[model samples]
Target: NKGIGGFMMIKNFKASEKIGDIVARFPKAAEVFKIYNIDFCCGGDRPLSQAIEEQKLNQKEILERLEEQYGTLRSMELEDVDFRKLSMTELIDHILNTHHVFVKTELPRISDLITKILRVHSVEHGQTLSQVHKLFGSLRMEMEQHLIKEEEILFPKIKEYEQNPSDQLLAEIISVMEETENEHDGAGDLIKSLRTVTNDFNAPSNSCASFVLTYKRLEEFESDLFQHIHLENNILFPRIKA
Candidate 1:
């Protein structure tokens, strides 16, 4: 049974389950799905095994990592908490201060780098440069709107519920959060596409230092996003779940 859960991890999602359903039940799968450019939200109704095979990924390696990371995923204690039990205002403040700040600061830098690289190499990598631009624009717009929606609508309602917990308010906030999560899925898709268009951000063998630095920065940005999303999706939202 060692491989049952690992293999089954990819196997079950193929049985008419949508991407969001799989991701909702197995959040860790997001990390894997992101790696493969699978649309686990909007275009989520596909076989996991087929997706993997079509991408030519090594299933053994994926299964091994899945087993290592989430072999006992079912028994994991992921519980909802009363946001009232904690400081909702402070949590919102933290998300804005840290994550929003990161987004604002890093996005322009990535955009500048994309423009720079395209200026230098677009003639040689025209299609990739075009994709990079498209991905960057999509991500920037999506994330900006997402943060606005969360801060203006969802977070405020969540805070209100903290002070005055009500079923009606909680229901509305949950609905909003679920929508935000789907947007997160799309943002995740943009990042995956960006990496692909950048050739995994591999600078040419003869690339200058600026090219190397840009790739490093992009890599760091993606890593930070993974952590940022994890905290929001796994910790913050769960705390507010009724």
Candidate 2:
């Protein structure tokens, strides 16, 4: 994060630009918006100007913070390539290779951690940990099947559409993307439920290392899942046959 005076000059933001578009472009803004309880996910269609006014927020401060946070990225020599600019084929490949692989790898590891923590700490944190484990199990199962569906059905059709674009194929892409987005929402809802139950990733004072580690890993998993969904929902899906 940079100082307000060190913030970048953002001339591209339009008055009518929605909050989701802002987060999709400047992800750091998501944190600032979250501070104000602004929804940049499901109910993110409202314009920034309107949201600020309605919530009695300081528009200038929000803009300054967003620019400051985004400025840090500008200040750094980052190797991160923007997935949105890639060709449809390239983007789909990157999603499968990057985000999908990460979810698969991290999900199982965290699942194991949660299970162990629940068993060991069952006497102390059993109720909450148990709920977290069950919710996470459901989420993991959903994601496992979700990735398979994308790999076997969605990505192949997207690739086929890339080779031969047509109105019918475009409709199919839209339909599949819609279904995929819904599943993403379901997974997101489950994570939110877990977060609520866990007091936003705070570990109990008497928590063991495993307990702390499980909460930390769960938070990391939630962050990755959000970024994954944002990439597909905000960027890739919109480019289909555009």
Candidate 3:
């Protein structure tokens, strides 16, 4: 009876469920998916069943693991301050403090490290570091402009709309925010290219310290950018529109 009950619990996880929903709802599942090298960020709209099948993993094992990790995921998301519940101002401040600050600190440090890697490891890696440097430099420049646009124009308008609630303002917000989404997509595409050029951020064997650190920082950047986009595109924007 105990085993049967457990099987029933696992059965509740349908293959049709969206991967992002699973991760957002079950924070522990995010780590589990990470172990499987599953992308729960950009490609998160794919079905759970499809994702597991693509990885050729045992569904039962995944379900069992997810069932175990289910506890406290909701609480963790709460502690992270679910964007849906936050006021417009709080959301802006949170984005600036958390995601924006992370990029501002990490990007330049990582850029320098990758430059060092290019100097040291370019021979063995066949210009891989150079490619990464170019892509990352482009991404950083785009993101800086994007962030400034948000801080100077779109975000302030959204905050103002929160207070005033005018149709004219809302229309303008939608127009500018859509442009922001385009920038997000551009940044995302660059990250995807960077990942491809770097072969999914795997440093070569016998890689130096700079090589390893650069790859690590690039992976962290990708992860953070995805979360940043999710907050704006999925949670906050829709809430404002609603």
Q: Give the candidate number with the greatest TM-score.
A: 3
- What TM-score fits each model? 0.61, 0.66, 0.66
Cα lDDT of model 2 by residue, 98-139, tens digit: 466457657777899998988888997889988998999999
Error of 1 at 10 (Å): 40
- Candidate 3: lDDT over CA atoms? 0.76
lDDT of each: 0.68, 0.76, 0.76
* CA error at residue 137 for candidate 1, angstroms: 1.2
Give each model's clash number: 0, 0, 0
TM-score of 3: 0.66
Give candidate 2's TM-score: 0.66
Which is the winner by lDDT between candidate 1 and candidate 2? 2
Which order, best to worst by lDDT? 2, 3, 1
Q: For each candidate in turn, give its C-alpha RMSD to the true structure in angstroms.
A: 17.2, 16.3, 15.7
Runs with alpha carbons beyond 4 Å of true place in candidate 2:
1-80
| Consecutive 10-residue window with the lowest summed lDDT within model 1 | 1-10
Candidate 2 weakest ten by summed lDDT: 1-10
Our model 2 lands, by Cα RMSD against the true structure, at 16.3
Per-residue lDDT over 1-242 for candidate 3, one digit per residue giving the tens place of the 0 to 100 score: 12221111213245577888676434446778888888899979999888888889888887777755542221233354556878988777667655665566567777898888888776887577778889999998999899878878998899999888999999999989999999999999999999999889998888877787678778877977988898899988887678
Clashing pairs in 2: none
**Residue 78 C-alpha lDDT in model 2:** 33
**How many residue-pair clashes does candidate 2 contain?**
0
